[model samples]
Target chain A: MRQTILSISNLSKTFGGVVATDDLSLDVEQGELHAIIGPNGAGKTTLIAQLSGEIFPDNGRILFQNKNITMLPPFKRSHLGIARSFQITSLMQGMDVIDNVALATQANDGHAYKFWKPARDDRDLRQSAIDALKEVGLEGREFEKVQNLSHGEHRQLEIAMALATQPHLLLLDEPMAGMGTEEGDKILKILQKLKKRKTILLIEHDMDVVFALADRITVLVYGRAIASGSPQSIKTDERVREAYLGTEGDLNC
Target chain B: MRNLLTRKSFNFAFIISVGLLALLPLYVEMTGDDFYLDLANRLMILAIAAVSLNLILGHGGMISFGHAAYLGIGAYSVGIPAYYEIYDGLFQIITAVFVSGVFALLTGAVSLRTKGVYFIMITMAFTQMAFFGIVSIEEYGGDDGLVIDTRSTFGNFFDLEDTVTLYYFVFVSLLISLFIVKRIMESRFGMVISGSKSNERRMQSIGYNTYRYKLVCYVLSGCLCGYAGALLGNFTNFISPEMMDWTASGELIFMVLLGGSGALLGPLWGAASFVLLEEWLSSITTYWHFFFGALLILVVLFARGGIDGLLSKIGLSK
Candidate 1:
């Protein structure tokens, strides 16, 4: 049996009287690409936020590597080998791509308060940031400002930044939100390549990408997990069909 | 080489300007213009204070409107010590830095919790509170302020009593501060700060405790401003509640904005130009503040990036 790296046991959250995430429990094994697919406003982003320590769940707990990380801040979770990429383009737009990723790398390293010594001169950090950029196929574009990059390139840079943290598990929210077919295919190919070495919990809207990438699929409907299974089982599940797919399943996917 | 110079052009300009300033007093003495030397010394003190403000407003992205409170604290540091006959120069400077840092910590803790305009308002409110508090201190000259009979001395090792020596002293202190600010801005922590300014939400997500980082920068900026306050007190032979006034705070902001807040040296230039303009305009008319205020308005509206921005536009910045 594959060992679980992240276990969300009965996690629940409520804002005022509305339930944002209701008694949701799921497990992601080590080295698996788990997909959480749902419609808009299905609490997909909120669930990812809770996992990455952006928000705290109202009930139950989250265990990472068998240790409770229920109350850790986003940065603390990042230090403990968990990294996340924002759904929106949240990079330092004025700075170069290499520098953006370097910010993440610098955080996990020793004290950043050392004055008089230039951060760029640190060979290890510079090389690692470059290497991570290369992994996302951004090798030739390291010096370019992030604001100048295309939407597709920005998405790639976001993934590259998360990769630079040298995360054991990557939490990506809406990686392919706004992309053309070619761009989507480019990211799909990259994620396909990365799946071999890293564990990923991806929240995606594209059914095709989710089905293609997810080793295990978890369906969330109105903040509740309706079904959990392999992509093949999920495609055939009646409850999932009624809740998410409905009559327009063939047209949408 | 041109790209490299442009990257740190503000610093290069600062060095050249300082070199010119060092030779200025000699030219003034030759021409029998002692008044220009006095003006130079005054500008130097304001430059020192503005440079400190740049650390927070420019580099740290914490737009504080109450930074002059530290200047008041620093000035009082010298006055209170001198009034009590504790006139050691080094000791007075040390006390000023400590008091300013403590004030920064207490005020920044409360103000930093809310961001944007709220932060500005909170800082302004605190500065007003300090201004009023000083006014109510009837023992220390109250609303009129206090004066020190003698400038501080370094335990008889050196005397800052001479005008020529003091001008050089203030100039050199500004130089040292420029170097320190430059060093701090290039470090790894500096990268995090710049990163936060560009995208704070991303920095927080990437594991940086931004609140702590901003607070450190705030305290460091305040301490540096206090050093300037110490020098100003000795130079003028007086300290006043006017140093903590809201207009004084606004002037600091204007200095940072006018010089091109993009680089540290810009604030120094901004301070010098502003003080010199005030001196020149006041000679022509007593209501010089109206013109200065109008100029600032123009800078904000048209020259959004300030003097450095204009210099860069004309291909002269580097």
Candidate 2:
């Protein structure tokens, strides 16, 4: 009898003649790692965008902690404890690694209208950023500029920023998209550790990671959810196999 | 590769420049050339205006082409009162800041909704509107401009009419403005503004209401520039509609770009070089503008970071 943390009811969005999110409905329970998988052009990014308030659904409602948040802007949703990591690693590239994480922590703490004290001198904020970076295994690279970080490190930093916000639910969009096997393993370990503490909605393209990490799996096909079940059931489900898993090659791994 | 010089060296250069400016009046007096005092005053006033512009343009990534409108509003705030013989320095400065702040709030509310080229064009249009409005006011000398009978008075504490007193006053004000702007840039509020400039969509995703922060920055920049306008009106003892012309706004942008947009002392360096070039070139030829324009083009082409950037290149990599 797990409690539902996020409930998307009949969400629909379209771009011109293309239906990007076609009457999609799904529920994620507290502390459960729910993964969304689909082929290219299956509107996986579009679904994440709607949940994070980047794009609005033409019809339907989104509920977080039993409160409707369909129309709330991204910042409001973030304040309500929904944090997201981007698929493309959207960070302040010119800033230092610690400062980037500190900004995320600062956003929810209080009003940022205080114009006198330097943020760099705020020990609490800096410590919080350091702790988040430590969690992501980026301890000694605090002052390094984000532009100089490796692709794997950027992905790790992305997750660190999301975690620094102290979110109740994490919406991770391809957290290991463009990484080598070593980098991917590092993120997997981090995600595995995070799974014990937070409710995670993961969007991943790698079948092995999805099968290993996801408690429940939802397969999307052309903006519609075609199957929803436990990873064991989804692996065996004939419709999911034909719609997506088949084209992704053998799901045996 | 390691940098040739560190940030410490850049800072040393900044301190030396400020020190030179502080002792400029003594140098002018010793050289028996009182005209340098006037040039120094003009440079400091414009430097204040350029620093204000840098807050929005350099830090916030807002391109306002109508920033000169605030300057005009500030000057008229002083001129209109002086027309009635008020001649109070505090009142003139207060009104100038207030008027410019309100105008920025209103215009920024609308202009901030648009981005890129639209923001520039809308700001330009707003400045032109302010220019025309001032031009049609016959009581304040209309397009012909107005002259103050007496400089603003600060009671027995200070006299604006005394050239030496005025020089010290402007010099102190410039330093204060620089300190305030630099402090704001280092604050938590500054992080959000700079973050927005870097990636606005990412900022929103991270839970920042960027619009509100940007508007506040806009108003604050306008207020500072308006103060500079008030000082300029006192310096020249005249206020005119031409002060807020679009070309004047362009010159301010050039100053920011020429010095270094985001650097603290870049605008000051830009203002000094621009004014000195104008004076030196105009003495040689009447068509000095052509040469100035060429210099600006060269700066834009070769010196992407302006003078401050060039200085940084010689020292730190940043």
Candidate 3:
């Protein structure tokens, strides 16, 4: 039996008069790649933010591994093995590429009080960071400054940092948002390998990548999960067609 | 852009400069020309203050404009006790650090909640409050300042009454302060502080409670600045409300920027360059502030990372 790794119950959040997430309930099975698809302003990023504890929902209960994580701070959420990547490529700029990932790894270790030994001199820490970079195809670019990287490389570094955290569940917001076909494929392959071990809640706009990687799909419209099921069910659901997938009709992007 | 002032490339400059400083008092002892010793002492004391500010301003991305308040607090720890004929060196040092630490914890709890310019404004306001509070105490000479007739006494083994002893005291304090900051900057705690400075939001997502780290950094900085103030009190034989004015805080910041804010040895370099510039510019013209302002703009525009960056760019550091 596949246990639910994460369960969100009746999540509702509004920014002033505008509703961002409204009465939404969702669940992700263990070791499954779940993709969230929605139009622009459909509260995709907003949901990701709530899941990552960047913002609290007006009302909701977030359960990770059956533990109630509602009202927890972002760092607390991170401590409970929930890692996240920002869609806007939030990274530690001016730091070296490997140093960015190493910080994330150090964050996972959660022992930041030691104030004498040099962090860079820790070979174990450096090796793990290097491993994360190589997993995302970013090896040999360790010493490059983050600002010096290209946009696509920034996206890869974002994933590398997330990977460095060594989380049980990964919350990714538009991992392939600004990439050429080749770079997108690179991330797709990484996600395929990652799903075998970690549960992923992915927010992506690229339909082709969505169909290629997701074990299941949830279609969101105006902050509500209008339809959700296996890829075949979502593609054929009539309400999903009218609310979000109307023009796209086919599952093959 | 090339890597600017990475720790790997800084050994050449820092080692050479510190070595020169370490050997300086010997030259002074032999020559009896105590002028350079006095100047070096002043810059080194100020350099310690600058370094403390850099802990928050550079690594933690906190721009505190009220740092000189701790300077006053430390000096008063010496001055106020001495006013009653209580001049225990250990008691003065303990009182200075304790008071500044408490002040930092209280003020930082409020100021760290603000960001950017608001943070800067709030810190300056707190320092001004300290300045005004000291000014109102009529018993301590108030606006006129208090002069210390006797220096701090450490039993019998180490007496600060000797001029050379006091100079060496300041010198050792400067070296110790630099060493502590340098070690902290490379440690795990430093990684989090530096990372938070880069992107605080991302740091939270990565499991760091950035506020606590920054607050701790702020307190550490304030306490160290207070210690520097204690030394200044002993060296100058004077303590006044004027020492903690907001402009004094501004000058400390100026030293940090001129040296290289994030670079480990930047503040020391900054204090040296600032003192030399002030001496040289005033010698040439009375309109030194105007010339200094123009020079600040030039350094900020072209040298982004300050003197250390310039040296690294010229391949002189590596």
Write down the C-alpha DockQ for each prediction: 0.64, 0.60, 0.64
TM-score of each: 0.95, 0.97, 0.95
Over the stretch B225-291, how does candidate 2's per-residue lDDT look in tens digits? 9999998888888889999999999989989988988888889888988889899999999999999
The parts of candidate 2 lying over 4 Å away from their true place are A245-249, B1-10, B316-318
Compute the TM-score of each model's chain A versus the native chain A and list the values.
Answer: 0.96, 0.97, 0.97
DockQ of 2: 0.60
**Chain B: TM-scores of all predictions:** 0.94, 0.94, 0.94
**How close to the true structure is residue A32 of candidate 3, measured as C-alpha lDDT?**
92
Residue range A1-253, candidate 1, lDDT tens digits: 7899999999999999888899999999999999999878789999989998989999989999998999998888888889888898799978878889988888888576776777766768878988998888888787788999999999999999999888899999999979999999999999999999999999998888988899999999889999999998988888888888785465135
Of candidate 3 chain B, the 10-residue stretch with the lowest lDDT total is B1-10
Specify the highest-TM-score model's number. 2
Q: At residue B218, give the lDDT of candidate 2.
A: 98
> Where does model 1 exceed 4 Å of error?
B1-15
Give the CAPRI class of candidate 2: medium
Task: Evaluate model 3 with DockQ and give the value.
Answer: 0.64
After TM-score superposition, the amount by which residue B69's alpha carbon in candidate 3 deviates from its true location, in angstroms, is: 1.0
Compared with the true structure, the alpha-carbon lDDT of candidate 3 equals 0.89
